[model samples]
Target: WVDAPNLASRILSMTQKRIAHDWMHCYQYAPVLIETFVETPRFPGTCYKAANWTWLGTTKGVGRLGNSHKPTLPQKNIWVYPLKKRFRQILCSNVQ
Candidate 1:
């Protein structure tokens, strides 16, 4: 349920209570690993990050074809950490 930025905050807050009760309770701590399926260019995840979520990695490019094989849909990307970990890593990769 990736919502637009404008809608994320409102939706998160609105669902906080229930989320904490229903979802959060699943683990002892408030859950640290947060994975999501991101295929669409438009997704509202900042709000989730702010709430303490982690992004893993993104899916491969588009579908692929092979001999007598069906093409597969693009994988769902995963963004971890409230700070967009993957992006930061790329930015700092060349730093000394």
Candidate 2:
């Protein structure tokens, strides 16, 4: 999800505190998810930085898979950061 600054963190933080009863869980592969991508340093974009998202690296580019089952153009990898475990609740159901 693309975030316009702390909007992501703020929403996530709110969810963690108000939802799921604060029971946090982590996936088996959660330790090392690919964060950020390969891109030019601050490529004349994104003027503001989200307080929680740290600049990891960059990616070349991204592309959509074609209908013929072919790889499309590549895109740059963007920034990513570790979401506090509790915030993960937003990805699940709130059913008791």
Best by TM-score: 1
TM-score of each: 0.38, 0.31
User: What tens-digit string does per-residue lDDT give for candidate 2 at 9-37?
Assistant: 56645743543333325332333222444
Task: Kindly report which residue pairs in candidate 1 clash with one another.
Answer: 54-80, 54-81, 55-79, 55-80, 55-81, 56-80, 57-78
Q: Report the C-alpha lDDT of model 1 over 1-96, residue by residue, as the tens digit.
A: 764765765665565434435554676444222345666456655666665555667666545454445435655657544223365565577899
Poorest 10 consecutive residues by lDDT, candidate 1: 27-36
Give candidate 1's error at residue 79 in angstroms.
3.2
Q: Which stretches of candidate 2 lie over 4 Å from their true place?
A: 1-6, 12-48, 62-74, 83-96
What's the CA error at residue 63 for candidate 1, in Å? 11
Candidate 1 error regions (>4 Å):
1-5, 24-32, 41-53, 61-71, 80-96
Evaluate candidate 2 by giving its C-alpha RMSD to the native, one decimal: 10.5
lDDT of 2 at 65: 40
